[model samples]
Target chain A: MKKIDICLTPELLHLYELTDRIVVVVDILRATSCMTTALAHGVEKIIPVATLEECRALQAQGYISAAERDAKKADGFELDNSPFSYMQEHLKGKTIAMTTTNGTLAITRSREAIQVIIGSFLNKTAVVEYLRSQPHDVLILCAGWKGRVNLEDTLFAGAVVDELKDEFLIEDDATLGAHTIYGCAKYNMLKSMASSSHVKRLHRLNLARDIEFCIREDEYQVIPILQGNALVAMVKA
Target chain B: MKKIDICLTPELLHLYELTDRIVVVVDILRATSCMTTALAHGVEKIIPVATLEECRALQAQGYISAAERDAKKADGFELDNSPFSYMQEHLKGKTIAMTTTNGTLAITRSREAIQVIIGSFLNKTAVVEYLRSQPHDVLILCAGWKGRVNLEDTLFAGAVVDELKDEFLIEDDATLGAHTIYGCAKYNMLKSMASSSHVKRLHRLNLARDIEFCIREDEYQVIPILQGNALVAMVKA
Candidate 1:
């Protein structure tokens, strides 16, 4: 059986051999959630940049800029890290250049993988289905806050593992731990995450609704996958 | 109130500030458990080295050499990674030089902290008591198997968080997640860790009794604290 593993944070990515694996990059509070939401709602594609300057540079090419740092929108960006902003009708068919403190960095760092895909609660079912159809091992990479492990991303990872456990070999402790955390939090994720650092960080910025929206299951059916330099919605086969 | 955090693996240690923190280094499957047992049973001191060569060199200075790699004792070493060996009556007053894949590396890497201490299920109560008396932030550093996270050490870290939650500000997701994992696994840790990677590795080597002995709570009342270059049991007032 193929293996399903989890890298709790990007800093520990070096320990894994990503060569033949399908990497599911998750940043549940936002980032990947926004990308999943954006694509599902009609945004053409997303260009995930590592820095705000790179995101800003793409604006000159007519791409919409979405940037966040420390839980707030970066100055001069056209959009912030929220799924609601990406769902606006005006953004249909628009290309977005995005950079965030954690999520974008995780996506860029995972370029070495055979396949890099965005994962979030909004697109969990789609991600599971996509992985179920593939023949390679899966690595759930949680984009934790600034190199630190966070609960929300891990919960999303666990949710996927719970769905795929019967079909995949759950061998690593990180995956087991994430699966257990999901078992505990799936009943009332928002309440379970009331004490989480990232939840509190976003709540202080009045993004509680975004947090709620991010954790809602199966809100979208699209998977944002890396294609060369940009992320495009993978066409369902 | 002081803050309590857990660094799940040593590779993530760079993300944390260790200069003024009290680092609790734990390798529950063997290394730290052996250190605590040795010090509690009248062993003079343990010199934890990162490499087997360092441990072998200390053997020339009349110190007993204990080295483990990939869960087996090194060929030329006098002692293996079992707590029972340290419990023997013949080892009294002997100084041990130890090296292991995970535990010793964690101890040496944590030298930057104001205080470096060894913790395991063998001395969980003593570790909590020492932390309660200290005025600095606590960072439970799990010596994961070769920089990858493991269930036993994370559960041990969670056990400590459960005891000290009310006394400390459990701010990070790692501590909160660990506390939750402890809540789920405390009732039956061995079974919870049956599927753990390291447990299966040691069990294949017929070290099941060592695993059972390592998780026994409060078996030792001693807290092993690092002083200069050796670990010696702290005197309780």
Candidate 2:
């Protein structure tokens, strides 16, 4: 059996030997979720830029733009990082130039991996199905909040791990750690993590709805895969 | 009141503004714990080097040396990174040089902070008491396993937050996150985190006793403080 592991946070990355693995990048609240939703809702593709300047520059070439910072939609962009924003009919058939605080950085970091797929609760089943067909080792990259391991990303990784456990060998400590956290929080994830610093921050900013929305499982069937600098929906191979 | 927080892992570090806060480095498995035990048992000041070569050079200078990698004591060192090894009567009154994978790196990274202290469950009460008296903002630097967040450090940070909750306002998400984990683990910390990746790895290596020893609260009254290149017991002001 091939070794499959999850890096709970990007900082745990140094321990990973990523030469032959298929890396899945997850930022559940709300980068990957937004990307997955946008693609599922018929947005053409997403250009994930690491910075606002990159998003604006991409938008200058006439692409629609979406930007987010601190979990809220950035001003002057065509859209925000919220999944609700991506569910609009206007976004259908449009290409989005998107930038976020953490998720975009994770995608950029995993460019060296053989394959990089975006994983979120929004497209959990699709991502798992895609991984099941591939014979490569899997590495779930949790795009934790601003480089810190937060609850949502790890839980998403756990959700993936729960699905793939029978097929892959969990090799890393992070995978085990994330799974343990997920098992502990699965009953009432939002309430269990209510005191989480990220949750508290979101609550303070009046973004509690976003947290509740992000944790809903398998809401969409689209699997977003990285193609060069952009993420597009993967067609069945 | 200024915000005092500790990043339990480098991943969660992105949320912290490290410019002005005092960061106390803690890695109970077992760098900080070893350092506290060494100082408490009457060992003369200890030098924490980042690499084995640095430890070797200090060893050549007639200083007793210790080094650890991946939770195992380094080969050919007089002392391993275990707190048990440092509790020997022979270690008393002798200056020692030490190096480990995570804790030392944390200390080096936080060298620019206004002040740095070593914290562990063993010295919990003393550490909390000392932080309560300091005027500068406090940040707990959990020298996580390698560069990732580990359970013990975050649990210890939560203990600090729980202790200092009345005196300080926790502003960072990492702090809030640690407190949540602590709340979940407080009733039976060992059981709650018994399956943690690090703990399981330690158990597999037959180091379960070390985990139990490391989590014992208030076992040592000594609080380690960083001064010049060494961490010595803080002489209470």
Candidate 3:
């Protein structure tokens, strides 16, 4: 069986030894969440840019622009980091060039992996199904906040491990650690992470609703795969 | 009250707005453990260089050398990563220049903090005493394996939090998360983490004894402090 592992943060990436694995990038609050929701709600595709300048350049070339830094919408962008922002009718059928604080950087960094897929709680089942079909080893890349392991991403990894443990060999301690954290917190995630610095920061910003919404499992079925510089919904071959 | 936090891994480090806090670095899987033991055994001082070349250059100046990478002794070095290596009579009263895979890199990255202290389970009480005397905020830096969060360092952080919780405010979710992890595994740490990738790798190399020795509480009472590019034990003025 192919080994399944979890990298709790982008900084733990060197341990990835990423020569042959298919890396599933996750940013549960709220980059991948936003991407999944965007595609599910009829957005055409997301071009994940590493910087605001790149996002603006894509806009200059006629794509709809969205940029977030520190979890808030940048001054010139049309949408914020909130998944709710992507649910609007105006976003439907439009291509978005997006930049985020942590998630985009992770996607860019894992470009060298055999394949990079965006994983979120919104599309958990579909992601698991796709991984089960692939022949390669799987690595869940949690795009932790600024290179630090945060609860939401690890919880998502845990949920994935919980779903796939029967089909794959989970070899890394981080994988077991994530599953343990998920098992303990899955019942009432908000209460479990009420004291999380990221959640508190969101609460401070009056975006607690975003945190609640992001944790809802399997809300969407869109499995996003990196194609060139953009993430397009995976189409079964 | 000063905010105190522990980053369970170097990947989690950037989450720290490390602008003005005192960073206490802990790498129980030997670097910080070795430093604590070296000081406790009456070694005069420790110079932590980031590279083996620097250690070699320091050794050329007549300093005794101790260098390690991936938990093994460097070629031609007098000491390996094991704390037991520092316990020998030859190290008594001698200045040693040292470099290791993770801990030294963490200390180097944390040079910008208000203060940086090397911490391990061995020197837990002395570290708490020092923190009690200082007025600055504190951040426990876990020099996790090659920048990933490992079990032993997080456990050590939990031990410190358990000790100093009355005086310092635990302000971040990572600290709470680490404390919870420690609480869950306190009674059976060796068994709980026997499956860890780092531990397994160590076991493959016959270094399980080093892991056991590294996690023992209060094995030493010496706290290593960074002073002008080298880590030396603090002397009371």
Candidate 4:
């Protein structure tokens, strides 16, 4: 039987050998959600860079860039960490060089995996369909706040595990924890996540709309797949 | 306002500088629960050693000892990681040297905290009552399985947060995640933990009854305090 494991945070990457596993990287609060939204709206590709310098260097090469940190847009970046920011009409067919505090770091750290697929509540079904088609083991890796585990990403991981747990063995306590949390919050995602640290933080910064947008299920049907340092929408056959 | 936080793993001890926080260490699937059961049964003090050598050294110096690893009793040890084993008739007024995989490591790593109190479902009410009287910030630290985060500890941490969340400002996503899980599992503790990795592991070893005893709420009013090198049941005045 295929196994389903959850690495709750990128810091736990050392715990698993990711030789042939399909890694689904989730940052549901905004990063992956934004990437999914961008791809759904016809954005060509997203180059997720780990550092601000790399994003800036890519921007100098004429690619549009966005930067975010501590729930705010970094200086000198045209866009911040909002799903709506990535939905601009001009962004259609334009490649984006993006850097965020959590998502970009997770994607960069997980570069060694066989396949790294972007996961978000916005694109859950598409990602799930892709996972069902794969013969390899699936690992839902949450891109937590900085290196510590966060609530929103974990809830997303749990949601995926809940849908596909019967098909594979639930590997660890962390995975079970995620599945349990998903059971609790699956009924009302918005209300359940209202008190989450990231949601609460963004609310304090008057970004409540972003939280609502990020957690909206099936908002995007495209599964963003990493190919040669860029994430582009790919339809699973 | 006072703040409430939860560190789900001992590996996160470095992320927190516990200068003014009342640190409550919870190892709910057995260690802290065992300590609580022992104290409630009138055991004098527990010398929690992180390493087998330290436990052995303490044992050699005229103290009863118990050693546990990977959900099983270690070789040459008279006792295992069950709460019922500590509820012995002969254990009254006796000191013990103990070493376990997760709990002892958390207790050792949290040596820098201002106050370290052992927490379990058995002593939930007493721990909460004590926290209510404390002016310092509170950090519920879960001693997870090995260095990885676990479901039961996080659920226990959440249960504590659920009670005290209104009184204090929750600090981070980890805390929120814990609180959410607690909200999910509060009504049916056993059912919620039925699928956890550790519980299933112990169940396979025929330790199903231990799981029942460990999750019993407020079974004991004794809160074990880490005083110098020993854990002694301390009643809050």
Candidate 5:
């Protein structure tokens, strides 16, 4: 069986051997969810930059920009990291340059893996199906808040483990822990996440609608795979 | 109100502020359990060193050396990391020089904190009570397996969160995650840990007794607090 593991935060990514693994980078609160929604809603591709300046510079090259910092929209950006923002009718076929506090950094850092795929609850089934058909082991890299582990990302990783347990060997404590947590929270995820720091943070910023939208399972049947600095929809084999 | 946080691994310790907080370092599979057992069995003090060479050097100075690597006893050490070894009558009144793959490394790295204390299921109540009376915030530092998060340690950290939730503000997701994991595992911990990688590793090495002993609640009523380079039992007023 192929093996599955979870790197709880990008800061601890160095401890895991990234070679020969399919890295599923998840930032469920907004980043990956927005990317999934953008692709499914007909956006051409997303350029995930690590800094605001990098994202801003892309605008001069005709790329629409979306940037967020500390759970709020950055100044002068066309859009924040809300899934609803990506569904705009005017954005059809337009390429977006995006930068967020955690998700983009996670994508950039996972370049060493055999393949890096974006994962979130919005397109969770598509991600599981993609991994099921792949040959390499899987490492769910959670883009935790500011390099600290968060519940929403961990729960999404756990959902993947629960779906792929039969085909993948759960070899690490982190994987098993995620699976167990998912089992506990799958019934009432919003209630389970009531005490989550990210939920609280988003709630304080009046982004509860974004949280609800991000956690909605299988809302989009698309998988965003990182390809040469851009996240494009994976062509199903 | 005081606050409590769980640093899932020492590698992520940099993200947390350590000053003015009580750092409870736990390696529940054996290291912290052994230290608690030794201290409760009348061992004078324990000097936790990072490497085998340092522990071996202390042996020449009449300190009993205990060392472990990858769940096995290191060669040339006086004892392994099993809690049972610490219970031997001859160990009484002797200071120990100890090194382990995970636990001691956690202790050495947490030196920046205002207080560094050892925690284990063997001394869980003592650790909880001590933290209850302390004025500072608390950080439960798990000595994960070689800087990667492990279930046993994470569960122990969660146990602390569950017990102290009413008194401390859990403002982070890691702490809440741990607390939830503890709730899931507290009923039948061994069964909950049947899928844990560390549990499988220990069982493969015929160390089931050590795991059982280590997980026994309140087997020892001692809190080993670091003072200078030695861990001595805290004198309660």
Candidate 6:
């Protein structure tokens, strides 16, 4: 039986002796959600870089930059982390060079796994469906905020664990913790997390709708897998 | 108003430019609990070292050794991480040279903070009561298993947050996540954490009693504060 584990925050990556596991990187508060939404909306490829400099440098290579710093659009970047921005008509078939505070950092750090992919509430079913097909043990990697654990990411990680709770042999305290958190937040996520620091911060700044849209279950059905540093839609034949 | 934040694992220390805040280091499985118990039971002082070598070296200087590695007492050490083990008749008025897998590591890493203290379910109220009196911001640093997040430590961190939720300005997602986990586990800590890996591991080894005893809320009322290189009971005036 394959075991399912989780690294609730990317900061814990150094503690894991990761190898041959299917890693699903989740950043529910906008980054991975945006990436999932981008693939679902027909973006050609997403080159996820870790630094703002890398996101800027890629523009020279004909990749349109979509960068974020601390939940806002990077000062000079052409795109913010909003899912709605990924739905633009002109971005179809174009490659996006993207960087964010949390999501991209997790993607770069997860290169050691057998496979790395993007996941969020927006594409929850697609991710769960795809993982249920893979034979290897699963590792849900939460791209927390700037090297710290965040609620939205933890909630998404937990949600996936709940979805696959019966299909896999859950391993470690984190897997169980994520499962417990998801159960508490699934029915009324916004209400459950009304007091969470990130949710409260974003709500105060009037970004409540982003949190609202990000938690919508199964809104899109797409799994973005990393193929040599670019996230492309994993199309099943 | 002081802002209360959390670094759930040692890996997040870099993200926090910590200053002027009191850091409560928690290793709820057994270590911090043991330290708190040792102090509550009138142990003179505990010199917490991060390695087996440091603990062993102190034995030659007349300090009794207490060391654990991979959840068991280290070879030739005088004691393991069980809190019950600390309630010994001979342990009173004695200074223990202690080292554990997670607790000592977190204490060592928390040197940059204004102060570091030990916290566990055993000394829950003592820690909270003391924090309520202090004017400084509080940071509950969970000493997770080997730099990774663990169930018991995160739960203890959450308990502290819940106790202080109304009094402090909680600053991050990890803080909120901890509080939520605490809420789910408060009424039935053992049952809520039955599926967590550490609990199962200890149960298989017939140490279920230790788990039950460790989660007993406010079982002891001693606050162990780091004084110089040793953790001594903070004498209240």
- Give the number of the best model, judged by DockQ: 1
DockQ of candidate 6 against the true complex: 0.74
lDDT of 4 by residue, A126-205 (tens): 88888888899988889988778888898899889888987888768888877878888788888888877788889989
Q: Which ten residues in a row have the lowest lDDT in candidate 2 chain A?
A: A171-180
Model 4 chain A lowest lDDT segment of ten: A192-201
Instruction: Give Cα distance to truth, residue A135, candidate 3, Å.
Output: 0.8
lDDT per residue, candidate 2, A116-160, as tens digits? Answer: 999887777888988899889988988887666677777778778
Score chain A of model 2 by TM-score against the reference chain A: 0.94
* lDDT of candidate 3 over A121-169, digit per residue (tens): 8899999999999899999998888766788888889899999999899
Candidate 3 C-alpha lDDT tens digits along B4-102: 898877666766877788899988888999999988888878988889999999989999998988878899887888988888887788999999999
> Of models 2 and 6, which has the larger TM-score?
6
How do the predictions measure up, each by TM-score? 0.98, 0.87, 0.89, 0.93, 0.98, 0.95
Measured with C-alpha atoms, the lDDT of residue B30 in candidate 4 is 93
> What TM-score applies to chain A of candidate 6?
0.96
Model 4: lDDT equals: 0.88
- What would you estimate as the lDDT of candidate 2? 0.81
Q: Which segments of candidate 2 are over 4 A away from where they belong?
A: A2-4, A11-14, A71-76, A162-168, A192-212, B10-15, B18-20, B187-194, B197-209
The TM-score between candidate 3 and the true structure equals 0.89
The interface root-mean-square deviation of each model, in the order shown, is: 0.6, 3.8, 2.3, 1.5, 0.9, 1.5
DockQ of each: 0.90, 0.34, 0.44, 0.62, 0.85, 0.74
Give lDDT tens digits, candidate 6, residues B3-40.
78877788787888668989999988888989998988
lDDT of 2 by residue, B105-130 (tens): 78877777878789888999988888
**Model 5 misplacement above 4 A:** none
Candidate structures ordered by DockQ, highest first: 1, 5, 6, 4, 3, 2
